[model samples]
Target: MSGAPAGRAVAWLPVARPLTLVPAPPPEAAAAALGTVWPALRRALAGDAPLAVLPAGAGPADAARAVLRPDRPLEPGTDLVVVTSGSTGGGKGVLLSAAALRASAAATLGRLGGPGSWLLALPTSAVGGLQVLVRSALADREPAVLDRGEPLAAALARLPAGDRRYTALVPTQLRRYLADEPDALASFDGIVVGGAATDPALLARARAAGVRLHTSYGMSETAGGCVYDGVPLDGVGVRVAEGVELTGPVLAHGYRLDPAATGEAFADGWFRTRDAGSLAADGTLTVHGRLDDVVISGGVNVAPQAVEAALREHPSVADAVVTGRPDPEWGQRVVAGVVPAPGAVPELAELRPWVAARLGAAAAPRELHLLDSVPTLHTGKPDRRAVARLHGGDQ
Candidate 1:
């Protein structure tokens, strides 16, 4: 389980030394708590008293410690362990060495032009948020936490004007900002969006509003985003067969305390991603969706992402999530959970025809459930299982 870089000796730490598990403070306290966490995090990245950051909530802390086993010794070169449920909703500890984390940060800064100030808009518990800290630390600049209870404009104004400001956000957060404060969003030199796919329409809107948005791909296993704007970062490699596989200095060592899962995912020097994507001739990568998300509806392979993208473009639909459920006739039927546009009442009749025309009859959702908002996980991705439950009359 050693994550030691090639040619480096595996220097095992003493068993009595346990890595500290720091639970991120609530949003309001996060900015103040940074002073404490930053020092510890810097030490961890320097390979002294490595630690794991548990999520803000109580359940995540308990769950993380149960698996983290702080009293036990870690594999050689392992500096940080990030606990992620990822898109599958099952928790796993992702082991990342200091070298890997630093490489990801350096490559990201290189790709983005140069190092500068960063706004911490995402939660620290997640890899994306942690990367914000990592990049900020390496850049020798303190990050501004968005959780400081200030308006977006006020926060943006506080960032150093001399430096090229950057921030990371999920699509949901980006949408809200685009709707409420477009000017503030445009202040950043770069904005990296990841955790889930960003709708093309949304990207167009953001770009039109002068928002410099960079769509990112990768997960906690890659120490945050290894790919930005469909291009792999410096020194990172991307190959797509049945699923996306990544290899490079940025890849995580392996999962902590779970050799079986680790071996299955990281093998032959590549980490197999659950995403299904394709690499274009020009080297651009297009991620379709999760490999398991493809639905065989009416004997037709339907990609939920395509349907969801089409649904979002409709005038009456503000946001939408598509999933497949059991059906007697089709074996599996496509279902939609939609959030209607402002003051708009979206009906199944109009929506069905809209999707049918854009995609196809088989791709259209057979059932539509209108809601004020779609259910999402902590990472801001739509909770597909929860959406399925809602469609099944669970409310």
Candidate 2:
């Protein structure tokens, strides 16, 4: 085991002396470094072993190896464990393997024209953020990390003009960047938006502003995103029977120390995503919403995604998330949390009829909450749990 300071904002060059207990090896310098660390990372996450991982704001010398007691035995194939954003339920650690992560990285690089220098706007702890780091390391280029809380324009200014600069962002970040600094959005060769549903209008606006935005679909089990701009990357397969189940080399081994979850997630070698989606005729995967996101109101299944898509058409609505709230009469009711466009305010009454006409009355939201900003997970997806918690009680 080795220790080193996490790289800084501009260039993420390694710092600190390498320790024998926890050897600090650069993933870029050694293609097999991830494989070398995979076993340790797996054991550490499984609670069967202890390893030192540098926490945020901690220096290299502060690294300490702490043992994690296993509640249960981790399955044999587990290699890496990643915790999901605990929105709907308590966060569960997802298990993956070095092979899966590497395969995903290879597929992504193949589809995205191989990697170059990446701009790290998101944190590395997240699957998406980790993908960025992995891609940069595989490409042997140090990513430029954006200063925390820095304006989008200021962050864009740091990168020198290049033919291949890439970055990943959530829909909210895309909306804010498009609204505040449209020109800045065009600086990157490619911009990936995912983690939550992205409003069509925002995508249109970004495209109009000359931003090459691509919507991604995947989760931690698949080693970040395996789909780009609706199309599954080479070697990634999408099937929608029962739910959106993905099959490919990128699928993870299983959940660490949770055989039940691992069995539930892996069926016939395909990862069964809780998300509901459809694969188009041309192989594009259009994700509708989560399987659990559907609201049963008066015995009718109300798709929140339908309502959210309809509301997003409104010029004033920059982003929208619709969820179900427990209701005594109808069992559940549709509610929406909306982020308005710059200098614009949303009127629920005016927007109701518009949504009703598009998605039908049953799918239209009964209550609309205008938010200054939509809550997002570290992965850049909408915090649906937060939205439900904030507005669900009222309904």
| RMSD values, in order shown | 5.1, 10.4
Model 1 gets an lDDT of 0.86
**How do the predictions measure up, each by TM-score?**
0.92, 0.78
lDDT of 1 by residue, 1-395 (tens): 95879988887755544687777777777685477667778888888878788777787678878878876678667889888854555688899989999999999989888999998888787888889999999999988888745678877776898999999999988988999899999988999999888989899999999999999999989999999999999899999876999999999989888899999999999999988999999999999889887878899988888899899999998999988888889988898889999999898899989999988999988888888898876556788878877777221
Cα misplacement distance, residue 380 of candidate 2 (Å): 2.7
Per-residue lDDT of model 2, residues 69-109, tens digit only: 13334444454455566556655666665577778877777
Model 1 earns a TM-score of 0.92
lDDT, residue 14, model 2: 37
Clashing pairs in 1: none
